[model samples]
Target: MLSRPDVAVVGAGPVGLGIAWRCAARGLRVVVHDPAPGSGASHVAAGMLAPVAEAYFGEHELTGLLTASAARWPAFAAELTAATGADIGYRTEGTLMVGLTADDLAEARRLWAYQQGLGLPVTPLRPSALRDREPALAPRVRGGALAATDHQVDPRRLVPALRTAAERAGATLLPTAVRRLSDVDARVTVVAAGCGAAALTGLPVRPVKGQVLRLRAPGGVPPGFRHVIRGYADGEHVYLVPREDGEVVVGATVEERTDTDVSAGAVLRLLRAAVDLLPELAEYDLVETLAGLRPGTPDNAPILGPLPDRPGVLLATGHHRHGIVLTPVTADLIADLVVTGTPDPLLAPFTPARFLPPNPAGPVGVTGPVGVAELAESADSAGIAGSAATGGSAATAGSASVVRSAAGVAPAVPAVGGRTGPGPSAPEEEHTWN
Candidate 1:
């Protein structure tokens, strides 16, 4: 048997799994390493496929990148669903950017102007019109804009589907952490681990912590939300995403931190803002409260592509809050680069060479990839394994575990399409930005 795979993907988050799936589907012998495949930022992601809704100032480049990926979601979702036989709960009804005060309406006008300037498809709505679209919205809403192209997916479903699809496509999932990289003699190795990539890739991948909450309607009751609602209440951004099974996800609180503590203050603020937007939410059951870390860059954009001097290494981390939205595009582009050795024009601006100094190394060593220092000898002494060809056989340590309920109580598994599964426990992604 070959000692090394054609590609070794570090990090089994959505982005990593997506890349592994694409590479394996293209006939590459691939292996993926992660403590948990779909947890981390992906587990807490709101899975909003909102390019237009997420647009902001001086991010036109990111907008183009996001829009390109957003355009790929429909086909990508359908293909993955067809392959995995799992419904990812992809909703296309669109997103409403509502304002709940006169001040909020002013902000909405500014956002609407910006969207219009970009030639984005957004429809302006009066308070009455907003109520007509989503009657559950608070009557205090002053006005809003609807980005009909924006959509969402349930990352909880997406992660499993991607994992199953990747394994089915022949990618081996090694449930362990990758603290360093060495010569694998493969075409390319990718580091897609969220904040964990910073240690291995030597890139400035920071974790932006966000706390989110999940709510469920009373049994036999409907969530009463037809489209995703992104509303501004008292100057805070709040969103309500309804699931097919009567669970509504209301999140999140953005705090720049490194710890994973789910603070009561954050939860109070999130739920309070959620109820301000959709008053009916006060009657729902608060099922979960969790915190996650989004792998962010200094500029809040992703760092992608290969290292100029590293012959077989790629950097696909630093997606920040947009990891889930950009998964498909990142997977396709990275897979193409790994297999064909050609850089797509879209990847030009995101090359890892932009961050690292150039150097030529004839062999993989204590120091692997570009600009990355040697792995600590202590790590090797701890039996975590080391060196060029060690794809550390699937260690049970740090294996993906079942998500626990965030409330420190038992989780309520809701039935979807007649199948009961784990409910929201820990972190996922955000539907709104701070």
Candidate 2:
């Protein structure tokens, strides 16, 4: 008998379970360890499988990976469901990128042009076309476009299905948290521990908190809309994902903090925008309010491949907001590296070595999100992001040290460095919606 399992995976979230499943299916002995498996983005994210929408400027590499993974979602979802005999709530009605106000439409047009320049199929649609897809959308919606390949899945159902599939594939789950890398004894140790991985590997992974609210439709019926709605209402960027079971996941407030408290301000902002776009949502009953953290990296890209300066170790963490949508591709790529002992070309750009030599001075500088505030007539909003490299939130303050949360009030902090002070300002023209 073998002395130990071939693979000892740290983390039991969807990414960890997915890697375990793929490895076990290939006849590898895999044991996954975690204190709470599905306690991360699996429960918090809106689960938007939107590559075209995610394709941002200066992040083509990450965009390529996202697009590749999104392409595999259909087959991956089907296989997971078949293996577990459970529904993952995968939907492919596509996404409607709408704008409720003329300003929203104009700002989005610049992004649409940039996206189209990159050859993405972001087809503009008339107001009538948008309503035809989602009649419940407020009649005032000016116009929008269609990202026909942008889809969604319910992460609440997805995690359970991934766990069931991994277990059935001969992988073992140990309900134990790995506090140190030295304790694991396996031929290969893969750390897919999300934010926890940073503590274990000294990586730059950090926690990005997001607050989300779940609402259920009345009368036991599905939501009136068929397509996922990622749009701006009254200049606030928000996304509405409706499920087949009469549930709509309206969220979320992105913050640079670590706490998971669901603020009343977040709920009010999200619900206001949601109802403004979809009037029928006003009747939905608020069912649950929760918050979760996304694992973020320094460069805003997933860290794959072997750990630099460490042999027999691999990483599969720092997925950030794209974790749910990027699960299949990450799992497959990590498993392939473990099985063949070779990193794929696609993994070359995201290696841990990029931030190597261990900065002895201190943690890496602020290459991350700044608290963003927007000026609205009757409402205000705030947000943050996972990393510095993926285009941090727009800040008129022009300094990274001005990090703060948007809690529906303008900050009164005095100006610093003679630049625009840290507070709510006019929404800077940019492509921040993802």
Candidate 3:
């Protein structure tokens, strides 16, 4: 039997790492388990950190979360880098949403207007102005929008840095896969396991498959594209993210309720759209193609904070594609909740109980929320002992709390930094692509 920890965090992706790091930072003994630590979606992400550009319809909650996370990134990066001596390649170059055709332009305009309606800082740009700002864009492009507050970081660098920082913070990282959460009994167990959450039982998390392509920047291709460029064409969203080393990553096709295999059709479709956006990309060498699963939830938002039906368990998964952008804030909030028993106000809307049937009295019986006991019971009812073992723990019964319940629950809100919110414009700073 493993020693009990204050917290046992499942999955070692960015979210899990972030939780473990934050918990350890607060002096909590943390144990993190993953088959391959840092080798999940977090590592495979394009690392676009562009909350504004990645905006979706009816994702206000996610947008708020992203904004909060973006605001916390600088301090998080600085501390991690200082401790691990690793450069996470954080950049504040902003992002450009370009349109290569009339349809693209119309969509860009619509999105820009929507952003404006949300009180977000978005600047409309003509084709000529866009070309002037980013000479690499095709001259035929008509218009675009500039979200100067959207920034990016290199996931490859950031994940490793986070892993190092978590270790330095004294979290025990187990390289072995956790077949079951029953292996340890902690004061709290957080299920932050991305797509793998479903396999652990009781968690309603499922995989939303996504595929991305990596290409080597050709000679004469600028060493770095200052801003992440994204656009829609052929009914798909395509992005070109340039790394400092001249490796341009063009990605991502979202396929729901399926296995995470890089489909040739998806690759062809993505590359075709990428070349359509920037014809010059045709000259680059295709290097790698990979696929990963983003954790999907019912509302397309993360299931955060404590579970109403499970006292010592927390739900921190289901971030979908915004996981990379929301990492820092998620970590901070999880740590705050576990250490002090208080959660961030922003986390209220994402409570796991939102998915549970409302019980005025309290959670009871087997049909409450998708908590630990419910999952374990379901597995047993199905005679799936393996699943039950993996599911882990008992459920607690209570209504959600509106009050701060403990001392370590709220971190002193630090001075916000990075490009976030509708703020005054600043000169574009030089940013490394990697």
Using lDDT, give the best candidate's number: 2
- Once superposed on the true structure, which residue ranges of model 3 sit more than 4 Å away at CA? 1-3, 219-224, 363-434
Q: Model 1, 293-333: lDDT tens per residue?
A: 99888878898865443445678999988998999989987
Ranking by lDDT: 2, 1, 3
| Predicted structure 1, TM vs. truth | 0.81
Query: What would the TM-score be for candidate 2 when compared with the true structure?
Result: 0.81
Candidate 2 lDDT (Cα, 0 to 1): 0.74
Worst 10 residues of 1 by lDDT: 405-414
Which candidate, 1 or 3, would have the higher lDDT against the true structure?
Answer: 1
TM-score of each: 0.81, 0.81, 0.81
Give per-residue CA lDDT, model 3, range 139-219, as digits (tens).
667788899988888888888888888888788887666555454356567878887665553557777888999988776
The CA lDDT of each predicted structure is 0.73, 0.74, 0.70
State the lDDT of candidate 2 residue by residue for 130-180, as single tens digits: 877788889988999999999999988888888888889788898887767
Number of clashes recorded per candidate: 8, 1, 6
